[model samples]
Target: MHLYERLPIFVFEIEACENLTYITMAIRFNLDRTGRHLSLKDWQALPYAAREALAGYIPGDDDFPARLDQLVSDHLGRSPDTAGDAPDMAWEDTHALPPGLLAQCALADLAPPSVADWAGLTPFRRYVLTKLSRRTDKQNHCFVPAMLEFRLAQATL
Candidate 1:
């Protein structure tokens, strides 16, 4: 799996069962570097502050996955699972629209952002778009809404 697949936190939309209304699920991943999925109880057992830190952290650098493990260790007073090797991923902060993101928009037939328009985005928004584009559906459904939210794309009926 790409390291993005193992992101510690993300926001996704889920259709509400009764009304077919969409709700955002701001979920945190409880998976460890060793590929252990922490049970909900175990995740809840963690100190709230630590959980908050993990949730807000923006992953960067080669040591990031390890740093995330350290976050868990700081609170648990012990190590998180290390029984498996972590996948290598560049966690660098980016300033430009990633090629994959362009491809994603093109494949979906949306207008790709011009360089000036892309540069107007904050790093966090760029990061979210980059991650979202790499996601399931190749981000076909979510990408347009995000672009529209940023005023980078025109809305269609």
Candidate 2:
């Protein structure tokens, strides 16, 4: 049997980052809203307490963008950019890779995962793959590594 067969279905390791910017990004994605822009510099400049609060805050309703703006204004001296509509994607589709992400995997020479394989992943992992494969990301150094880490793709020596 292959070594991967002996491993758990998910073995995620938390990667350390210098700022809370990605948390904000994940929040925006989860909320399906946008335009409360916080620059990376601004994100890094916030006090740890503020950052923690923002990261931990989950909106119980659809008013999250406004709430996020309030948080940003509390930390910074001014309101952030106004909230706007974000594109809705197939967040619930687990049977196949999204077209963009599949294309990315093909470009990387990774095998197209089976439907069962796709459904095996948690939503957060799926979101990570989707976010990394987005066209505007510019840097995708993490894509293949993330795929390998998730055991959805093989590593070529």
Candidate 3:
């Protein structure tokens, strides 16, 4: 009936006293509905990239999520920065805002619009750019792309 619900309720075979990795349980569609396989044909049908990504998973690795995020980015030629809220970034050696962001915006003659766009961003969005800019080792290759991405997004608005 579904694709995942059939992952074989191995828990039922294990004694209640045994330790298992149950975090939460939810009902989902399962193809077998009685066994624990992804329907081999279904697995084979997945794109090669997707299969490779799945093959790379290492159970119990703390950085698995980050690795997967990077893989997805690499596959799509996406910005290296994770596309969400950036942690707090306070610049001690540089100007308040990242210079590369400004320079790129100026080069495009979109400074005014970019500034307006940056100013109008929700605090979280602004934080993403600031965090990217603040990474000392990556400033040369990062942030500008992110800024341009935002600039393009703003253009459409």
Q: Highest lDDT, which number?
A: 2
lDDT of 2 at 80: 71
User: What are the Cα lDDT values of the candidates?
Assistant: 0.51, 0.59, 0.37
- Tens digits of per-residue lDDT for model 3, 20-69: 22211110011111122332344344455554444433322344445444
Point out the worst 10-residue segment of candidate 2 by lDDT. Answer: 2-11
For model 2, residues 94-134, the per-residue Cα lDDT tens digits are: 86678768767777777867878877887666766776677
Pairing residues by index, what is the TM-score of model 1?
0.48
Runs in model 1 with CA error above 4 Å? 1-50, 56-71, 74-96, 135-137
How does each model score on TM-score? 0.48, 0.64, 0.27
Ordered by lDDT, highest first, the candidates read: 2, 1, 3
lDDT of 2: 0.59
Leading candidate by TM-score: 2
lDDT by residue (tens digit), candidate 1, 1-157: 4222443333233222112121111221123223433335544567755554444444333444565567657766666554354422211234455766777788778888887777677655665576466643455666776777778888777
User: Candidate 3: worst 10 consecutive residues by lDDT?
Assistant: 23-32
